[model samples]
Target: MVDIRSPCILVCSIDVKSGFCFGCGRTRAEIASWLSLTSQERDTIMAELPRRLETVERRPRRETRRARIARQRREGQ
Candidate 1:
């Protein structure tokens, strides 16, 4: 199966305040139509993710497994 480009880290919960995914920082509409979007479109969205994530008021209940791994890797580096 071809893996389309995605920022998902398997944390599939949405932040109610921002309407963006707690993990990938994408809205439900974006996530639902991701595969159908062009590379440029995805890139545009990806560029905004960090900023969008910062706007999330309510955080996830706990650290996601993928997030922990990424943190460990960054710390190790």
Candidate 2:
């Protein structure tokens, strides 16, 4: 069985609002099912991803500068 190549482009981060991965263009369910699919099946999903992404509405991320500073301080860098 040929392993289906992941569409993940090393961008593991998901948009908190959209519940979609910014890197691979996959939903949480799809990502979870990746290993279970054949390469051909994966290809079909990949082909449809662009259109799906276009239709998804993403929530805006709210990050304050103060919060960023606090996080940086905690990281000790």
Candidate 3:
């Protein structure tokens, strides 16, 4: 089984424009691929996260709910 622990901090917020997790500095694709990555890969990503986060400018959390809605709608039965 893949380890599914989230890299999120309490920030729980995201930048809609960049689709980056504010707390963990990971892109949505990176988060999705986490399970398939080796520990070394994960560690490398983790190590680079701080630098990536430094480049991220804070934006208001506008797309959080929208993203959820879109995702749910896409997955709807």
User: Candidates' lDDT values, in order?
Assistant: 0.87, 0.70, 0.72
Off by over 4 Å in 3: 1-6, 10-13, 16-19, 63-77
Q: How do the residues 34-55 of candidate 3 rate in per-residue lDDT, one tens digit apiece?
A: 8888888888888888887876
* TM-score of candidate 3 to 2 decimals: 0.59
Which residue pairs collide, candidate 1? none
Q: Is candidate 1 or candidate 3 better by lDDT?
A: 1
Q: How many backbone clashes are present in model 2?
A: 0
| Model 1: ten consecutive residues of lowest lDDT | 57-66
Better of 1 and 3 by TM-score: 1
Identify the superior model by TM-score, candidate 2 or candidate 3. 3
Q: Estimate each model's TM-score.
A: 0.72, 0.56, 0.59
The TM-score of predicted model 1 comes to 0.72
lDDT of 2 by residue, 1-77 (tens): 55557777654556666677665678888898999877778889899788666654543254434456678899996
Give per-residue CA lDDT, model 1, range 13-73, as digits (tens). Answer: 8888789888899999999999999889999999999999898865686777667778999
